[model samples]
Target: MAFEQSLRRPVAATIRMIVPAGGAKPAPPVGPALGQYRLNLMTFCKDFNARTQHIKPETPMSVLLTAYKDNTFDFIVKSPSVTWYLKKAAGIQAGSGKPGHETVATLSVKHIYEIAKIKQTDPNCQTMPLESICKSIISTARTMGIKVLKELD
Candidate 1:
């Protein structure tokens, strides 16, 4: 709590104006530039575990990864995270497998709101109000001349 609130350090900021995409060449990043994006990704990983540590131990382990080109989310697990949520957040449900064969699942996000809502319950997520996070990241990436090939929608 003290770390979250009381600790304060200088957050340097600089403004760089650039034409929007499909216009003139983009401007270079300002401030710490790409560091913020990396930090955010790392933060998301850490926060997810901390917030769910108690429930997660009893819950099964799973690996979550994304396919960048396809804009799809994938998970591989002997036991699914969904089953853990069903048991922990909802009323009791039957445990399907003490140890099941590893399975991988992938899904596309045709509707972004659906994913945003799902993100709320993500154990590894620290980002609430994803809209702003998305905007900042996209803007930063654009300014840095990084391509975003996938659409969340």
Candidate 2:
């Protein structure tokens, strides 16, 4: 079984990249990286764009790609980073420079829960409990100087 598996799909490279949602193009970053491996850039771009069409354009998507020796590839698209979600929820352009000392924005518990729910859809977070995901998001908010409030008062 192991021999058959290896022979069927021998991996040539593993690539990690952050591409904009629905914005895959055969250009500089995407082009050079996959072109070197002789993978069909147009196929990847079309598939990736179609998959991310539901997401807001320009949202950064984390992708893990496996290029096989036969010039074929497979990839997984992860949800956007927690920080991006937090910033969007808070309507902030960036995090506070001083973090603890400087308060940038406030988020209600509901907001945290919503973000957690969205994050739960990620493959890595699928196995984790919802409460654990909420806790991590809350921690991230604190580091970004965003206060978590019980209500939006």
Candidate 3:
């Protein structure tokens, strides 16, 4: 079984994107990205929307699509990004232009822990310890000019 699995051809391409749940369309970015792989854009859009229908329509999701040589494809949907959570928690619309030198907003360590817990649910993050995830989130928050505080008021 292992040998047979190894003999199988590698996937032809992988496309990664942050798409809104239930909001895919045959548009420029989606169409061109999938078109290059010779995959049916509509099929992917419909399937993706259907699978994510339970989530809120405007929620942003990370999707990883793997296209096989035989034209079949598979995908995995992940939770929203850490930066998105940070922005929402800090009540900021966007990051500061001068991240290292300027501070845009502040969030609590409680917020960091909550976001880290959420991120741990992602397949790629399942093996990471909560502390590591929180540290990563803290670094990302700093890059976005958001301070992670011991407590928030």
Query: Cα lDDT for residue 43, model 3?
Result: 92
Q: What are the per-residue Cα lDDT tens digits for candidate 1 across 15-119?
A: 222111222111232113324323233333344345445443534444333322222222222223333333332233443232223212212222223334544
Off by over 4 Å in 3: 1-7
Candidate with the larger TM-score of 1 and 3:
3
Cα error, residue 123 of model 3, in Å, equals: 1.4
What lDDT does candidate 3 reach at residue 82? 92
| Candidate 2 lDDT, 30-104, residue by residue in tens | 998899999999999999999999999999999999999899999999999999999999999999999999999
Report each candidate's C-alpha RMSD, comma-separated, in the order given.
20.4, 1.5, 2.1
- lDDT leader: 2
lDDT of each: 0.34, 0.96, 0.90
Quote the lDDT for 52 in model 2.
99
Model 1 worst lDDT run, 10 consecutive residues: 18-27
Q: How accurate is candidate 2 locally (lDDT)?
A: 0.96
Error of model 2, residue 10, in angstroms:
1.9
Each model's total of backbone clashes: 2, 0, 0
TM-score of 2: 0.93
Q: For model 3, state the Cα shift of residue 114 in Å.
A: 1.5
> How far out, in Å, is residue 91 in model 1?
2.9
